[model samples]
Target: MIAAKNVSLQYPDGTVALKNINLSVKPGELVYITGPSGSGKTSLLKLLMAMEFPTTGTLEIMGRSYGKGQTGPIRQLRRMLGPVFQDFKLIKGRTALENIMLGMRFLDIPASEMKKNATEALARVGLKKKANTPVENLSWGECQRISIARVLARKPLLILADEPTGNLDRENALNILELLVGCKDEQTAVLITTHATHLIPANQNRIIRLKEGVMEEAEA
Candidate 1:
């Protein structure tokens, strides 16, 4: 779960990236943050990821406060999170399975269990057959699914996907979104940031909008 109260982020250059943003996300919830370029969508996620500290207000991710002097805790907190970066971030020459396993190397899991997790994750993404293929040889959407598999292998408590559908066609984008939504369960919360509002399904109600550093809840 995440809780933010009056959070604001300002860069050293006097640029305000977010303004008085207050939000609460609970377990099993899938929330979508939508905004245009230069909006505060990514800024808000950076704050959650502890990549940037808020200039004002408070933030609590899974009951841990994030700010100055919390480096160690922040590092530990990151281990519980799965972040799907805008860039696929896969090593070019590595096989898809290897890429997923590489992500788990830092964890305390055993090698056998790690491989099991990685294989299962690949299956979840419908890429089990391509597990041995080098990521460089995979299609763009396949690479994206592989990225998601890497995150799923970690069994994270929270999933933060930033623009996971940015590079795909409409059908692929929708499929990617559905795949991400399927990852949500009783023990996991999902937060996705994207600019393509039209791609969002009509059944999704937990939506937030940002513009010029401002935050507003979408009308139900």
Candidate 2:
């Protein structure tokens, strides 16, 4: 569902974040982008998500090409993807239920239907008990779950998670991974970027490792 060819990214200061990366991810596949710090793992994800444009080469989402300052095409591409950040970008004052509902704000779903879907999503993340709690009052793990629940509510064609389990304990991290994997289906592609090797599944065949801005097959 996504492809990047000879993609390179450089900052205003001329620091190269990604270098000639070529990669493709298909629907229903769960892939991990693993690499060390400064290896451009996040940069690759940002390009795929259309948050950043590559300074060189091409990035294709679904079928459209994305280039610098092309907000119309980028926004159109993003509507089909759901992103979960490592920082758990939840509104502090909003309740978990509200946070999840925010994902469908662009849709014309009624308030009641939105609430129902949000509640079900929270239940899926084991956050039903904390549905009414403010995000600022939640623990780090709970906030993370809320982030996933928000993505689930969107039902995007592709899911992009960046260090999704970074701040959680072992059990919590496992639960988050399970939720993420469960979200995949024939129409959804899931791509995750993480530094923790243990976070990877043993039977996964789609893992791609990034090193010094290059892509390679992740060893089992």
Candidate 3:
């Protein structure tokens, strides 16, 4: 779950990345953030991930207040989030399974259980067949899924996907969206950001659009 009220972000350069943003995300909910480039899609995500603090107003994520000077708690909160960054930060030399498992090594899961979850995450993303393939050799789409599998293997309570369908074709893009939606449950919430509004599934109902740092509620 996430909550933001009259939130605004202004950098030292005096550029306001977001303005008067108000949002609330609940468990079991799937929300979409659609916007053009430089429209503050990434800035909103940064607020959620605690990468940037609000220049004004209040914000909270997963019940943790994301106020300035809370870096310690924010760092701990990150461990519970499944973030699929726009950039596929895959380890080039590692196998798909290994890359997925690497994200869980510091968690409480046992080694054997970790592998099981990694394998299961890969399968859920339709990449089980490529589990042993080196990440460097996989296609862009495959690498994207691998990045997703890595985050999913963590069993995060909140899933934040930034442009999960960036470079994929229609089929793959929809497949990725389906996988993301299916990952949510009663105790889990999902928030996805993408510039391709057309790729959003027809069933989606909650959408927020941003332009020039201004926020608006759009019918999905």
Q: Which candidate has the highest TM-score of all?
A: 1
Tens-digit lDDT track of model 3 for 145-179: 89889888999989999999998999999988888
The whole-model lDDT of each prediction reads 0.92, 0.86, 0.89
Instruction: After the best TM-score superposition of candidate 1, give how far the Cα of residue 38 lies from its true spot, in angstroms.
Output: 1.1
- Model 3, CA-based lDDT: 0.89
TM-score versus the correct structure, for each prediction: 0.95, 0.94, 0.95
**Residue clash pairs of candidate 1:** none
10 residues in a row with least lDDT, candidate 1 = 211-220
> What are the per-residue Cα lDDT tens digits for candidate 1 across 1-220?
8999999999999999999998999899999999898998888888989999989999999997877777888888888899898888999889999999998898888988999999999999999999999999999999999999999999899999999999899999998999999999999999999999999989896999999899966544
Error of 2 at 139 (Å): 0.4
What is the per-residue lDDT of model 2 for residues 29-135, given as tens digits with 9 covering 90 to 100?
A: 88888888778888888888877888998878898887778887677777688899989889878999988898888765687788888888999998999999999
Check candidate 3 and list the clashing pairs: none
Q: Judging by lDDT against the true structure, name the best candidate.
A: 1
Give the 10-residue window scoring lowest on summed lDDT in candidate 3: 62-71
C-alpha lDDT of residue 122 in model 3: 90
lDDT score, candidate 3, position 81: 89
Number of residue pairs clashing in candidate 2, backbone atoms closer than 3 angstroms, sequence gap of 3 or more or interchain: 0
In candidate 2, position 118 carries an lDDT of 89
Residue 114 of model 1: what lDDT? 98
